[model samples]
Target: MRTIAVTRYVTPLREGGSLPAIAEGDDGFLYVLKFRGAGQGTKALIAELIGGMIAKLLGLKVPELVYATIDEAFGRTEPDEEIQDLLKASVGLNIGVHYLSGSITYDPNVIQPDPQTASRIVWMDAFLTNVDRTCRNTNMLMWYKELWVIDHGACLYFHHSWDDWEAQSLKPFAAIKDHVLLPFAKELNAADQWAREKIDKSVLDAIVELIPDDWLSAESKLSFDEQRTVYKTFLWNRFTHSSIFLNQAIDARKALI
Candidate 1:
């Protein structure tokens, strides 16, 4: 991932709990930055990094993700104490998604993606065990007449508590039925086949490796390498047993249709 120095504190995007912000990067681009110092801390950033990468790897449309550097001087002028503390605590590496200028939230009633696209999104969410992306909060955007996914901090939930991660990997995501795109996801089988072909041990390695050590240290008591292993193992297990979730999605879609 490319690292950019955050030069300006544009504004705080207080939509969600993490308190993401619109910041200007040294590259002359505006980015929606996910701070590492927020309540969820670096774990959320890890999920955002891995989830966004996997989506891009699956040929999904996602804004460019970068490692945003929060230098000591940044955010010093923010008048809000909460925002200032968040900036002070996050004076290091954070995650940023290139802001899609003029992008609007996706409205299911206004437009529905094709079956194949919908099915792929459903399958990907199931694979990640993402619990966000619902009617109330679609977490999707329409930019330049194309669909773009964002805010994946809710994915990889198993990492938050690994006590049953092994078993958790095999369980189909029950929440998938509530997915915003499930109604049009008629191509689950096709998505299953595609994912099985695209994601492998190497692909998982690449994505997991992108996670900075700072993010891994806060998780559990395990060493960074150990945590990475657990993550890779869990993801591989889920990928191999994806049928469990694919079937769950198909059943849910069946009920919906």
Candidate 2:
């Protein structure tokens, strides 16, 4: 959506594998910057954009996604060699999530969500095929007493191998069993019905259109339109075939109980 220039490199948030940074934007707001030049590359950024947008559409709490511009000159002043290398590689447009200050990491044991909210979240993760939201690493935040989903770079794993995307899209998401909220997700069937109604072809198209062309063309052999089509097909197939994963989630909830 909005493009912002990274004015300052505040610090590296070393919690995850990506090493996303907390930086000040030209808009005078703090943002968690996901570098385009990182080891995971632009695909990870694409996952974040698509997953975050879908979550927002499903009425889940997610920070605003922004295009963050970074100047190569800014890397010269960084003291850490690791961060310096990362900045040097990410000299152009990057993905930034508006930072939520005073937000605490979500702990399922301490703060439990209602079954409806939890099931919606579980359904969202299953539909996206996100594998990172386990009890060990929730990748979620509790801000202002609301549960916010974050760090979706690990979703959409099929993108790494587009040849089998069609089959992968239909495969059940077994990883959903380990989802932190699975035990509390009592409304999986209802959540699936609601999502099927909301996330149609038009919604998938709008979300995939948000990804920049530069990211798609950087290292891929596919054309821009081809890339967009691939994403749309994968997501639409996943949404339509969600009953497979919905049943898995319900079974997991039963075992937990």
Candidate 3:
């Protein structure tokens, strides 16, 4: 992930509970900044990092992620108390997704992706246990006539309760029925095979390494190595048990059909 200094807080993107903001980086690029101090906290950022990297590896379109440095003083000029408070709390490192200019939110009713792409997305959500990509809020964008994924902060939900991560990781993702693309995903089996081949141990390692140490420390009491190991174990277990999710997805697709 690239690191950039947030030069300006442009505006608040009030779509979800976290209240991510659009900011201008020192590099003159716009980024949708996910604050470290949001209600969901650092774990949300961790999910975003891992999920976004995996999506990229699967040949899905996702915005570039950056380490956005926020100074406490950046919010001094902002008149809104909520924005001011958010910036003050997020004084250090935060996650930023490169903003897509002139892009429109994906509307399934108007635009439909090919079965191959749709299957890939469905398989990805099932694999990651992402519960956010529903019909009401697809978390997808239409840019340059292509589908791009965004806002993966809600994935890898097993991490939210570390008490039984191993067991939780093995559970089937039945929520896939609500996935916006389920109706169009006719090639899930093929997508499953392709994803399994790409997301090996090395790929998981690379993605985990992208997570900043501060974020990990802020969220868990575990040591850095311990946290990394936990994440690796959870992902490996989920990948090994992917059949549970795939079967659920197949069933969901049939219901939609």
Q: lDDT by residue for model 3 over 1-257, one digit each (tens)?
A: 78999999898989888889899999999999999888998889999999998999999999999889998678898999988888898999999999999999999999999999999999989888999999899999999999999999999987778888878888899899999999999999999899878889878877887788888865568898888888988888888888999999999889888
Error of 2 at 255 (Å): 2.3
lDDT tens readout by residue for model 2, 1-257: 89999999998998777889999998899999999888788889999999989988998899999999999698798889999999999999899999999999999999999988899999999888999999999999999999999999999988877878889989988898899999889888889888877788998999999889878865678789899999999998888788888888888788888
> What are the RMSD figures for all models against the true structure?
1.0, 1.1, 1.2
What Cα-based lDDT does every candidate model obtain? 0.92, 0.90, 0.90
Scored by lDDT, model 3 comes in at 0.90
Off by over 4 Å in 1: none
Q: What TM-score does each of the candidates earn? A: 0.98, 0.97, 0.97
With candidate 2 superimposed using the best TM-score fit, by how many Å does residue 9's alpha carbon deviate from the native? 0.4
Going through the candidates in the order shown, the clash numbers are 0, 0, 0
**Per-residue lDDT of candidate 1, residues 4-47 (tens digit):** 99999998887878899999999999999999999988889999
